[model samples]
Target: MFKGLKPIQYAGREVWPLIEGGKGVSATNHASSGAWAAAGGIGTVSAVNADSYDEDGNVIPQVYEGRTRTDRHQELIDYAIEGAVAQVERAHEIAGGKGAININVLWEMGGAEAVLQGVLERTKGKVAGVTCGAGMPYRLSEIAKQYGVYYLPIVSSGRAFRALWKRAYHKVPELLGAVVYEDPWLAGGHNGLSNAEDPTKPEDPFPRVKQLREMMRKEGISDDIPIVMAGGVWFLRDWNDWIDNDDLGKIAFQYGTRPLLTKESPIPDIWKDELTKIEEGDVLLHKFSPTGFYSSAVKNPFLRSLQGRSERQIPFSTEKAGEHTHQLDVGVKGKNFWVAAGDLLRAREWDGQGFTTALKTPDNTLVFVTPEERAMIRKDQADCMGCLSHCAFSSWKDHDNYSTGRLADPRSFCIQKSLQNIAHGADPHENLMFAGHAAYNFKTDPFYSNGFVPSVKELVDRILTGD
Candidate 1:
């Protein structure tokens, strides 16, 4: 049972210590988030390219009609604002003025500030707070204050929180509702892994969260403010000690993966069905995102293809030096292309296998792909609508001529395309499926035996029982 756990005051209201973690690309939508809110928990709506519906309740396809990158970017922002507004309105109606609903956005997403402002302007009292991460969102507090809503910053470690608090969060201390400590290595989708931390070794979150509490106390922040512990959270029984621990005051749990199978979830039936079949170790943390941040997803055929591409890569030089005396079999700039003798043989072998096209990454590395793959990559890059603030894949920057002045990296793929396709009922195995590490629990959990899918209220009720 959820003993000694009480409702925490958040967004000027009392709500359960359960938060529905925001999943992007319409994974969490009006139906899912609204039900979560009505269930007395905080419902988080994903503002990253949210979806809007037509008069008949059909999804409005996000088709870009602009011929240029700049033109398409404006279209993207307009679509984002429209979609967020619709989602918030529906969620508010379903909530019946109970619980709280928060909108989440990534700081690195293109037109983030504009989209947030526009959505909030239209949403008005519907939204309770804003949860932002994926970068140091120093402006989140100030912006949320302008809209008269609370602001929550998602961070990994205490040092990161300290830096943000000192920089800008200090001035708006009253508006800072809560701080989320997302385990970078364990969380799904884009994470906040820093250079000091090793991804292969995940440190225990207990000590890290305790350090954050100490930092908060020293800063004169109230112990009443909740610390949302996200990542790898499946069962409350596993975290019994954390519920009422003095070291970490007012703790809450955020679930990013478990909610995908609920009846109200907006994802396609195929996606929900696949969640019940996941096994331990099926989730993989990799660095294939165009945002240049580490992300976790199911190890599907789509990810396996990227892994194979990177594995076949080899370093090359412009001029012959040392063991690089062999002539390159592929012509790019000229015969000036130089590689080690062994690499030349490998390149030839790859070419014979029809992986003939060579593409250069910004890191001065070459990855070989088939002609079809090369054409697809070029087409995706050309169709960029500035979806990210600074994309490493397409080099589409949201500022100044809309270019990052670097060659598009072939190692990264366009996230917008893959996520949108999956959410729209594409083959789950061929798309990037963001999932938490504990997603495998769905397969073994008795609550989901025989492919039983519960309503949002039933799920929340079950969670309160410490199942």
Candidate 2:
């Protein structure tokens, strides 16, 4: 037995309680979000580096011509604004007065405020709301209010929402569309795990969401405001208890990973096929993103290479001390490099295996890699467009002299480049792929039997049956 969902009032219209989670780098575009909205659910167009088309209808490739990181960052912001405005306009047109259309952006992305303002100014009456996460977007409410649209702040915990309410959101409560409670442990892409939370031990989202509601009540916020549950959502039947529960208040569901397999999904066919092969534990939660946030991705060759590079690391000192009594003879041309005796032997072993290059990390550690790997790392770092506010990979900061004042880390990669490549039909195994933990359900769900992929409407209709 399953409980069916009822249409709820959103943006002054009746629509299903379902929502399509926004994915970045052209993953969620007009085709997907439009069809989702037409199916009577809220659809979110990703405003993070979305794609814009040429006059002939081909997607314009985003090629950076600026020589400096700051110059290129401006180019990126312009591209982002144009792309998001185009996407929202097209998505609204496709919806045809059916369901609401929202745009999602990462607060930590470079020039996030500028891009958001630009898109909102251009797509005045087209977009219904804005969804933001990845950092504390204290100005999101004000920006949404300026454009006469609702704002949804994605948070992982009740404490975070309380902080936001106390800081800025309380001033503009009317246009607060929904609070998205994204499960940090189960969510894909960048997670919101704080220093207080442990990565290994997963907590049940029911209790955490209940706490969020209780906090909201303390602030005198009405129960009518839906708390959209995102991340790890697969079959709606598993969440039957959450529906119509008094303690949880108004509830909604957001699908991030499940929507990627639909016919309207903008992801490449190779990515869609790869989603069906995921097994339990195949998606790993790791801390290798340039933004310094924990993210989840398939443990493919690209991710494994980062892991191996990190594993082959050792702490070094400029001069010999108590623990660093051995002089490093391999990988480095400098004679001042010192390491422990055990590390010295390991470095020699790695060098013998052709990992003859050593790169320094920001944490005073050295990672061994082959010459070709080192060259690729250097090239990627040089090609950075300052996508993030603060990037650990290239040490490129968005403000204050455009540097993080730390050594450029080799453990992370340029997320913008990899994501752009993957979105435009790059090999999934060689680029970064973001997915939720429940993605494994794609392989076992009977609705997807015989390699069948449903249209966005079919998927939405099937979901209403509690499948």
Candidate 3:
């Protein structure tokens, strides 16, 4: 038997504690999130490069015309603020004063504080809270206090929450809306897996959430402040024990993957169809993001190509030392390249296989690729608009000399380019498709059988029944 969920008081109103996960790059927009709020559940508008409309009510494509990376980064921030304000305004209109509306942003994104301040300034009463993650946001509470909105920080462990609470959040206790626990091994997109956590070993979320709750109690936080469980959540029936359990305290579910299949979802049709075809273990947790963070995505050719590139890598030394005795001649033009005997043969083999060009990485290694592949990688790097605060692929940093001071890594790709392409109408097989580990449930879940896609209302009602 499933324990039923009760409506909770939030943002000065009574509404269901359910929240729609805010997806980025135009995935979750006014349509889906607005409908979710209208269904009496909290809806989240993605403030990460949301879509803006032209006068004719058509989606305006974000095109950067700036000649330099820094200039183009400013353009990106402007687009983000404009698009987010529009999305919030439309969502509030669609909601008709039902459930509250929230906006989500990544603390590591370029010009994040500016974007948040700009959006909040324009849409004063529309947004109820700001959901931020991907990095430790000590200033989130301060920003929330400035705008009179609640702030929810997404964390993977109790230790992370403690750090935030001690540094800044304790001062603004009234506006700390909730703490989101995103499973690092299971959640989609940019994960919060720390260096101490093993990516291969997935830990259970129950004990972790319980630890977070206990820590919160010690900090004098009220039990009503929910620990919103995000990632890998499919059905409420499976989480019966978690609901109404005093150990966890005021739990709410946040669906990041399942809602992508709904009728109101703003993803492309091809992306929606691909969701149904996912099989078990199709999602991979990898560390290829340009932001130097681990992210989860579909293990398609796009991601496999990155893995293959990394596999073709071999360590090189400027001066001969230890096992680096063989002077490599293939792929690289410089005589300074020295490698091990076995790696030299492997490099030759890779060169013979059409990976004729070698690119240097920041880790003192070289990755072999075709000349055509090398050109594309270079072009993508040159075309970078500084989406993240720091990028490993282009070596572009938002502050301090505008460079990471390291060689741009060929092993990583331009995330802004790939996500924008996929969010538009690009082929799913060739783009980075982010999805949670539980995404495979779309295939086996009887609710999705017969290609029956539900509306936001239907999905919310069905979820309320513990399905």
Query: TM-scores of the models, in the given order?
Result: 0.98, 0.99, 0.99
The 0-to-1 C-alpha lDDT of every candidate, in the order given, reads: 0.91, 0.94, 0.94
For candidate 1, lDDT tens digit of each residue in 1-467? 47777888887778998999989879999888999999999999999899999999898999999999999999999999999899999998998888899999999999999999999999998999999999989999989989999999999988999999999999999888899999997898888899988889999999999999999999999888889999999889989999889999989999889889999999999999999889999999899999988999999999999998898788877777887888787624468778888888888888889888888888766788998999989999999988999999899999988889999999889899999999999999999999998999999999999889999999999999887
lDDT of 1 at 189: 89
lDDT (10s digit) by residue, model 3, range 167-282: 99999999999999999988999999988989999999999999999999999999999999999988998888998899999999898898899999989999999999999999
Clashes per candidate (backbone, < 3 Å): 0, 0, 0
Stretches of model 3 off by over 4 angstroms after superposition: none
Candidate 1 vs. true structure, TM-score:
0.98
Clashes of 1: 0
- RMSD per prediction, one decimal? 1.1, 0.9, 1.0
Which window of 10 residues has the lowest lDDT sum in candidate 1? 329-338
Between 1 and 2, whose lDDT is larger?
2
lDDT value, candidate 2, whole model: 0.94
- Model 2: residues with Cα > 4 Å off, grouped in runs: 1-4
lDDT of 2 by residue, 1-467 (tens): 24657888998899999999999989999999999999999999999999999999799999999999899999999999999988998999999999999999999999999999999999988888999999999999999989999999999999999999999999999999999999999999999999999999999999999999999999999999999999998888989999999999999999999889999999999999999999999999999999999999998999999999999999999998889999899998979999999999999999999999999998889999999999999999998898999999999989889999999999999899999999999999999999999998899999999999999999998888889
> Residue 45 lDDT in model 2?
99
Which of candidates 1 and 2 reaches a greater TM-score? 2
